[model samples]
Target: MPPSDLDLLLRLRLVVARVGESDNANWWASDGVLSPTGQYAYDRIAPRTGPFARARVAFAVAQERCASQVPPGALTLWTLPADTEEAFDDRWSHWLDHVEDWAPTFAAVEAINTSSILTALVEHGLIDGQHADAARALTAAPPDPSVRLAETAHIDVDAVRQLAAGFACSQPAALVVPYVRSNA
Candidate 1:
């Protein structure tokens, strides 16, 4: 049988955890935007396992399932950017060239906040309120620079594991990736 949407999400969380471990940084720091190291790790693993594709499928399924409760676009607030630097550069240049034209698009994107998404997810019985609360706390901005720095150094792997497991089952099978540490 094909894996369920929850299963794909769990696998994706595992990939994120592994990438974060490799970079010595919190994957949630960028609010779903993978850092360079994280991107490298994802790219390295994607071809072998297709986690991203599976994640996209899962996301699509969720969006369809929650269409009435949540706006489809809201589910993709942190969609990954294209893989090529040149594509990014071109897109950036275009945006820079037509900043005024893109203002409304930017505004619309910004209006879809994390809280609403989490609320919808919780209401739909997709995630527990505790998970949503934990996510909100993790993403909250600390006032102190020292505290922020300290927080960044620690990646909450257990929280992610718990969230994933909660979504899937009481005891989900582990995803095994042959991660080889490199000194390069």
Candidate 2:
């Protein structure tokens, strides 16, 4: 059976949470919520502006995806750090308004992940055989978080190689090409 949208997002979150693991391995919890470490990592990556900028972009996409799917007002309702429900609602709505500013960043994340990580997963044997079609389908554009997930989620090969390259000079820089295929 195909994976559910939440399943795919869960997988994506897992893969991304491990990025730069010497510093970010435990960035997220199993439930996909951001831990303190995750929040720090997000803060670190969010301001980056250069090559390999997907770290922060990914966080925004994942955050937005997660927030958009849950029951309306649930985050504010249950996550109130405020003394009053009214205050909680007001703060949460303000946060949502702030999140809207991340739309462009989220779009960039979708583009890079579709072009880079999605293809890299296949090239590195993280995706293969029957699952390739579903992975390929994702390259067209960022699907709704409600997209039917592939049974097997793709791997984060870029992180693997970066770890390897830390130990071996022979690791090729070209291993993780960030190019988008014209047909994708």
Which sections of candidate 1 miss by over 4 Å? 5-115, 142-184
Q: What lDDT does each candidate get?
A: 0.31, 0.30
Per-residue C-alpha lDDT of model 1 across residues 14-64, encoded as one tens digit per residue = 333322221222212233223333334554766433333333333343323
lDDT of candidate 2 over 136-179, digit per residue (tens): 44321222222222221222233222221211111111111111
Clashing pairs in 2: none
Give the lDDT of residue 14 in candidate 2.
Answer: 31
Taking all chains together, each candidate's TM-score versus the true structure is: 0.23, 0.24
Clashing pairs in 1: none
Question: All predictions: root-mean-square deviation over Cα?
Answer: 18.4, 16.8
